[model samples]
Target: MTSTMKPSYAIGVDVGATKIAAAWVELSTGQLGPVLRIPTRRDAPGEEIVADIISLALAIELPDNPDSALLLGVGVAVPELVDLHGTIRSQWNFPLPHLLDRLEAALSVPARAESDVRVAALAEARFGAGRDCDNFVYFSLGSGMSYTLCLNGKPYSGSHGFAIHFASSELAVPAQDRSALVAAIPEDYASGLGMVRLWQERGGFPLAQGIHTLEALAAQGNACAQNVIADAAGMGGRLIAQIVNMLDPEKIILGGGLGCSTGTYRTGLETEIRAHIWEQSCTNIPLVMAGLDENAGVIGAALAAAPPG
Candidate 1:
């Protein structure tokens, strides 16, 4: 749609490994309207996923009278490395360019796509904790871990559109076998999976309760759970320190399931980060939780699809 004809209502879709969330966003207020979520059919073909996205977008309530409102476009955030041309480059292969094309054709409107975490960063920069900061690092710690650097309100995707792979960073060197160092990636010690693995390794009874159970146990002062969380905090702190030292960002915003922990867990994380921060000047850089929480991806996608002023 032309800039003058651009609608206030746009659709934002956040596609994750397990689920997809789609919402209608009001561009003028940076507010999200109705949100709908469905299980991501990973086993299905790319065409099916594209169809699902378009169907969800169409399900939202919009003014039937074109004079009152319009459907501007759709923006999608996918959990895979996406190039500038909106092509997926990672192993969880999806034909993103083709998907966007299909979405545009099906919806009769423009469509844009971006990396999921990058889109989250965009949301934060525009409407969340990073709103006041010009440069910051956004770390997402959930079932998996990823980060995006936002400079001057734009995500800094590297030359190949893959800048930092936080999960794959080696946090420690294996003293016994140098060759096995690759197995000690930071995510193994810092992510939700890391917490579960650490708990099991400590002889804690394997509960099928997942990260929530572990966090609950830790809150109740379970020694084993506390230890697991501590290790994760230490590792996460080190990672944050490295990012600060390398980028000197104005702020560090944490998001996702594990990153937004409260009470002792949050304290532990902040303490570890403070302990590892290098320069005294860099020590005061704010570490905050994502203001938009789960909505960051969808809100960001909508903003991305909005016509520039």
Candidate 2:
């Protein structure tokens, strides 16, 4: 690690349901290279996806040597449960294992991977909303949902790296023949994707328009879509309130595809949380937007290799 030597350059990637993004960074300078993006091959399977990822990596021409970059290692933020050495078990949407195998075989460098949501949480802890405090939680709501807890400056990966999967507003089913009770919960009222689906099914709007962007609908003030958004926010509030009750995180940051758009939903969500949290005022929890924004996943995944202390 000589000062005169050029800083080590590492590649950073974020693979999600929406996109597969990659970057080259100078670890020593905290300087990130130009970021690149490509639509995720939705439900893309196996080797083709890997080849697609490698192809994207090659698509970029960094300021420095690309061939030498891998020696510094590549860090990937993937959507599924990844093992300590970067083996993915299963992902709800699109998934894969041994991403490192492809990179190593193609280029010959150590690679690492972790859940995209958890990586985003890591980014928040290191340089974003959770900057000052440890033992905080980063929650995200979108097509899929999850939350990550950073305790004592380290991201909480859970026993099996699946902590966030349970926080979903839709999946928290009651035990036994308690269908009636589960139905009463707000989660059944909305999940991000469910809301969009409901607009077409129950709400009656020309929603099936080939429009892919959430922004496209948000701009029109489409009342039906608005209702769906509010409903989804309310559902999130319940899950958030419960996390506050159990962990007492110092800061609660929102993130993910929906996190950025949540300014559109928070007022409703805050109102719902205030009404439901049992000891609300006594427990002061701050719900702030993620400062790191969309890049949290890639940045956090990199930190997984050197997560916040």
Candidate 3:
């Protein structure tokens, strides 16, 4: 209220497989109020999840007045494919038949939803690492893996709004002897779950359940843990190199829980990416870590409902 620019607020919700996080965000400056998080009811009924999202949105306290005119609608980042019409086209963690519609009807305000990865890319484009680039690829290495193309400060939602699915690509480690290719899903080796599974398969450590656990073991000088992390990062990097060779984007912005960290994974991925790049000149392309932390998805979700200037 003290600033020259008018203040606008939107409630952003990130509905992940494990947790649902909600926050009140100032759209103009991308500043978030205190965040509220709760475990997601992944196996619960669809209506319960929708109700929980609405409950989280309503809990955000607004300034001046709780029901002020400065408050915009709610935006949600879902863990599934969302079409142009704000409809979740596929079932991922759970089935939500009509999510946005229910939210809007219950809250008596407009609501918009998009794929979580794409929403994160939009947040980066507007307020994070991709802001300076005209075209960038937001490569997310999380519990699962995916990516989004940010073009001119906007995320490119494909025809059906399901374009980014890089994790599904069947790729293989290059064979030195030119033998037959053995293709595997990249996520099974590079993603958080993938890394854990890979660790178990290779008999690294029986107790490593998540990627963070592996990181901790690696820090403690565990050779198997370190090798698993490095190998996964290398595969991730090689895939990124392929992206560079094809799109040649202005920048590659890394996001997600795993990609944003500055650890062995980061070093290994960068080295592998440079080695696999088809063009020598392209190898120098910047790989910027996303500026926002865990808040990126919520901030981005709110941006979807922010009023246009």
Query: Which regions in candidate 2 have their CA more than 4 angstroms from the true location?
Result: 1-5, 64-71, 169-190, 206-223, 282-284, 305-309
* Whole-model lDDT, model 2: 0.68
**Backbone clashes in model 3, listed as residue pairs:** none
Q: Rank the candidates by lDDT, best first.
A: 3, 1, 2
Instruction: Residues 1-309, candidate 3: write the lDDT tens digits.
Output: 575545788889998877899988899889888899998998999889888888888788866566443778899998788888777777867887677888888777789988899989988999999888799999877878888998899898888888878877686766777786777898888888788888889876566347778888888999988999888888788888988898999999888888888877788889998899999988899988888977899999999876377
Local accuracy of candidate 1 as per-residue lDDT tens digits, 1-309: 655644588889998766789888878777787789998877888778777777887776654555677778889888788887667677554544377878888778898888888889988988899989889999987767889999988888898888747767565566675656544778777877777887888898886768788888878989888888888888888777878888888999998877787755578888887777889877888889999998998998888777467
- Give the lDDT of residue 144 in candidate 3: 81
Cα lDDT of model 2 by residue, 194-231, tens digit = 56666677645555532234335755776766676667
Would you give me the overall lDDT of model 1?
0.81
Clashes of 1: 0
Q: How far off is model 2, as Cα RMSD?
A: 3.9
Candidate 1: regions farther than 4 A off: 1-7, 41-51, 63-67, 93-98, 170-183, 201-209, 307-309
Over all chains combined, what TM-score does candidate 2 have? 0.83
Q: Could you tell me the C-alpha RMSD of candidate 3 in Å?
A: 2.8
